[model samples]
Target: MNSDEELSPFNSFQFWRVPLPELDLSLLETEPSAGSYIAPSTKDLEAMET
Candidate 1:
């Protein structure tokens, strides 16, 4: 997966898997990570090419 890509919400998950009988959508409202994404440059790629 690309670091710069924003992954879809539970790309491989289904809501039915949750065992809760009455889960609210508001409970899952949390901020995503603010970390900066760094894609390796050509120089770095070349160094590891061997």
Candidate 2:
């Protein structure tokens, strides 16, 4: 096979580009909340050791 045929197996190829709209952050919540942390189980700790 030639160099161009080896590079591309298809006879036709097309390239497309679509423009996206701008984003609005005014509707989103900006406040941060604290999350609760839980300790790992004894079974989980034993699996990590192996």
Candidate 3:
């Protein structure tokens, strides 16, 4: 009858029923946001070649 009993890892009957935190899905949004992406400069690219 207890919620904890249903969610406990010790309970083999509900081992897969443990609650999870809400996922951060902002990155999956269709629209891009400010600071979400950045283009590397020519100098930065050249340094990677070395």
Candidate 4:
């Protein structure tokens, strides 16, 4: 059971059984600043629709 075998999606049971990394709760507590995020332009949105 190598790291590759553990991570392979074809081995569904083994893939899901692998333990997930710990999450940082501090990130969730922090407030998002204004203009921190950028949205896709209308031109990009139109291309996606097609």
Ranking of models by TM-score: 2, 3, 1, 4
lDDT per residue (tens digit) for residues 1-50 in model 4: 57986667866886568698999987775677685776889999999999
lDDT of 3 by residue, 1-50 (tens): 66996667776666556688899987588877876776899999999999
lDDT tens readout by residue for model 1, 1-50 = 54533544445467336675876877575754467456899999999997
lDDT of 2 by residue, 1-50 (tens): 57886756454443233556888876474654356355789999999999
Task: State each model's CA lDDT, in order.
Answer: 0.65, 0.64, 0.78, 0.78
Error of 2 at 3 (Å): 99
**Which wins on TM-score, candidate 1 or candidate 3?**
3
What residue runs in model 1 are displaced by over 4 Å at the alpha carbon? Answer: 1-34
